[model samples]
Target: MASSTSLTLSQALLARATSLHQSSTDRVSLATFTGLKSSSTTTTTTPLLSSSRRAANRRCAALPGPARTRPGAVKAVSVETAVGQAADTALVEKSINTIRFLAIDAVEKANSGHPGLPMGCAPMGHVLYDEVMRYNPKNPYWFNRDRFVLSAGHGCMLQYALLHLAGYDSVQEEDLKSFRQWGSRTPGHPENFETPGVEVTTGPLGQGIANAVGLALAEKHLAARYNKPDNEIVDHYTYVILGDGCQMEGISNEACSLAGHWGLGKLIAFYDDNHISIDGDTEIAFTESVDKRFEGLGWHVIWVKNGNTGYDEIRAAIKEAKAVTDKPTLIKVTTTIGFGSPNKANSYSVHGSALGAKEVDATRKNLGWPFEPFHVPEDVKKHWSRHAPKGSALEAEWNAKFAEYEKKYKEEAAELKSIITGELPVGWEKALPTYTPESPADATRNLSQQCLNALAKVLPGFLGGSADLASSNMTLLKMFGDFQKDTPEERNVRFGVREHGMGAICNGIALHSPGGLIPYCATFFVFTDYMRAAIRISALSEAGVIYVMTHDSIGLGEDGPTHQPIEHIASFRAMPNILMLRPADGNETAGAYKVAVLNRKRPSILALSRQKLKQLPGTSIEGVEKGGYIISDNSSGNKPDVILIGTGSELEIAAQAAEELRKEGKAVRVVSFISWELFDEQSDAYKESVLPAAVSARVSIEAGSTFGWEKIIGSKGKAIGIDRFGASAPAGRIYKEYGLTAEAVIAAAKELS
Candidate 1:
């Protein structure tokens, strides 16, 4: 690690490129570190991978393809030289140029996208894909393949070009041409749902790095659980390329802090230190010593001064990063933003805009490239084509290794297989505890804890924690120990006071294995503001992360307005592709867990209460599944004098209101609108059965914003909610002061009737 090798420096010296002196000690000879295969057995030694793994890599040089070379080939390098000496400076330059132009040309064609990053970071991109990273482009979902995140996602062309060169079918020539277009696999940013090779949806700066931490954490946890000393199965690395913007975002610091604390050694992040943001040089607004900051954050910091062309420096940095086993590494690669463009190379003009036709011509002339747009020099193609076969062979070797491991460790293999392939146990839902009307009253957050512990017992991949609110949120998995640097296999993750990082990290965990790893994160409901971007990404990227938000409303009390989420539920309700669930009792809490577990492609937010409430009659696990169902009804013929609807802590109030109304000889139907999203998905007949369209006298009560309730309550109906901020008082007092009570519901219902 750089910290161990380098001398202690004063604050003044910390601003200097610290890794330059430290990197010299770690650089291996090109012969030993090169990506190319050596004819000389002595030169074939690679310190990065195990010798047994290297032996398994001895396979076909290329997949089956036509023998003849195409036009405009980089004839300077022969097929043998190109494949065998892929690390040769001249050949490597041509490959790097290919990546640069792919970005340049794609951006030129689209008339959009930030091109500076791809242009500057091409060397690192080329080295990673061509030399260092272990991935199967053809099988992007291969279980053991290394994960890569382009955290500076605006520079997605960098990733798109790499995917194209590495031979991902998702980014064929046509897809690159159709970049940023509707329905194109190559979107403006890397959306994992849109592109196969792209790992996570990361346009919002800082999120990808946070996600990378989660990915590394997942690797560490799984490795600890499944990797036997004799037969290691869960082993991989997570690499990320983040820019200055990511560093500027506070979320990155929060996540990186945790990454260092957790000692995610397998995570190596490449900080593209181009020093230029959209506004101009980062010095204009951001001039902090990032290396010093990261060092303080407990990361091994490395700096490659010549990122534009220092291929060996980048390689050496990566090699050194892998050697550091106690903490994550940050390789700061400083380079000119637009490396090759003569007129705009270091200027902000090239940060986002396309270098127009004349400059493109100048760039081409300068780089000595005459090929047409999207053209890959045949030598580069042939050189990169080896990865497909090599990747297949790697997966094959791993599969065989797993087969043997499975023979000896059947039970462990079954559990691991479930983690790899998203298959739940035969009756996983049955493991969720059920509660009857006779059950004691409890806070939904407490009920949620019961569900989480139960789920952890049955579901092998079920694991998560809170944003330093495990005690308040009641999200601790009682049976499991805290997941720390030493105890990686524990189900409980102590995320500290980092709500944004916690949310994004959980997104990464959920997306890591799709349906396999069901990661849940918890915090107070009001704190969603701190992590809305991450939660939104979870919705957009189809990450099934369960957000356990306690202190749902004014019911939390004393903490006052800032701590109470008046609009949180309504806001999440408006967001598409998310289930905003507010359970009233134990049965509904169990149902929320089931819904969260089953909806493997959609994220769920369970807004739980800090205050306890009674387990009301007619509130069932089955009724909660419908999102909204008649919990108590004295009405007949699907026609009631008034319909009372509520959620979370207020459902008991609505039930009480309904009882009072029913006593006055008025037909009342009390509906538990547990999840509006789920209820909207229910059949029209079922919806009508719960809240008949003919009945206009509907009264909806909730301790949230009255914003979107009009959609549920008809024109003649009323919504009783706290439109203003809550007061600092006892929970009961706050509820009474805010009129969030059965009396309010009864008044609204009678007025509507």
Candidate 2:
């Protein structure tokens, strides 16, 4: 059982079949599917062997003998086995057609769905689901299951049909009929939240491929960490079927480049190279050499000329992809948009629009399918009936193997279980290094690094890296090495400088094994503009990614206006389910980390500063958790004359201004607003206590745009912020020029009073 080389889908099946051959000695002929090579010397024995002889033969095969490593290789076949395989191949074709027409019927039923992708790519889908990929349909949460992402998610009916045929209880005929309808699991795009078998929420074109890369990275890392040479407990492949649009999007390049750089051999992608797009022909916009581009990106590329009919070529290409155990592979599958349509085969009408009732009937007639809509032939069902039981049995066998694994390595097994369940260990929060007012002031970005180091020691699920900005962003884990192709067990991931790809990859990692991995990525705060789409997907799909954004404001200084973020806070604050935390000091930074870790269904943006500030006395962890808390109470313990609200670097300005106002016998309450989203979730009593309706004389100050502050500060309040862009100068000069100072805050507070 020692794994010297990475196991592909074919090899894993062979291993399973080999194990079965040992237990069922009477069924020697059944070993043909194990990809075992037969020689002239080996003879097919009869099933009438005596029990004693059979037991000895089985025991010998089960024990270590010569290596049996040729999976999907050329093997000698007898006449009987060949005939049986021919019959099975015919059944496979029928299953493929069943997938095609089911999608067609569903799209026809829902007059607002895409049918072309499923029709053209049905053969590839069938080959992947029935002939190659491994999973337990009864339990889509299998840890070692192969992941399939439909990057061309507009073609989701293609996936839905496959899931239905593969026996997943999640997708039923009624679900298909309710496609794109309210409360149906089948949405317009393949949403991971909506569909059980869907891996990542796709439809934004290239993000799915990027998510696939992250999925493959997760498998490789876990396989390297927990997998023993003898017991490869963490093992699986990540497959994606993408279209021309996915390749056209720039994010695909950013992610695929990293995939190739990491040499993710288990990551196989099928590029459905259909020439037609929504705007007629793809030739008008996208005519680059994709094969050459993939080759340059360090991927193994193969071409299938006739994806409509070349089932054997598809199978061969997969075998070839699985053979290359050092680099990822892409199989360019050439297909017509509408494969069986009489007139609209390669036309733009087939891309998104339904093929109408007449075209559907004509296409069905041309394909010689006489069944009614949503109908599966009896032979097709009989052929596919074994898949459910087979999948369940495979899972049962793996569970038995894992029980042995747990017994031998108890501690590793416990840690792996924690990762699988995504449960933080008791007292794990103690690892978050605490700070006091007496502690030396440091940049929150630097404080974030300390948190990473502390959490790296405690949180078993914690592992991520920055987008090529780890050194400056203070995101490096001290004791861990980089998660490279050679050192996958390392906690730190190097995501190059691709912000968009980094965001999607983190999402994929969070979604991997259903939130088994707690992932975080970093970059300059302003650069969020580049990856906003992926970030939105993270919020929509509920991936709890820690976005450690540094250089949060004008405090970043001479790097200039492009690096400074003025309106960025307002932008992300507008986004739902994302915590926009701007911590003023070390303690507040630790609080942000705590929220990010605990909120398992939402992402958090920890906007850290480039400059250091004094740790204020009232800035407790409890206060920071409230999102907006009273840092300094009014001197008189009654309704304050005015309230000064601020966040990040500007909070200190508000505090200084409040002290000055208090010296003048004016009772001023300074409020530290760290996260608006977290604040909005608080009880009305809590929010009212923090910002009382009676205290209408409020003044807010931050270095960002004044767009969102009106909600916090009422009509009687004065908002002091730069509504314009910043300038290239020293940090102090920029803040002074932009009116982000204690003097300016005091003036604004006086004016409001």
- In candidate 2, the residue pairs with backbone N, CA or C atoms under 3 Å apart (3 or more residues apart, or in different chains) clash, namely none
Score each candidate by Cα lDDT: 0.82, 0.80
Predicted structure 1, TM vs. truth: 0.89
Deviating ranges (above 4 Å) for candidate 1: 1-85
Best-performing candidate as measured by lDDT? 1
For residues 698-726, could you state the per-residue lDDT of candidate 1 as single tens digits? 99899999998999997788999989888
TM-scores for all candidates: the values are: 0.89, 0.88
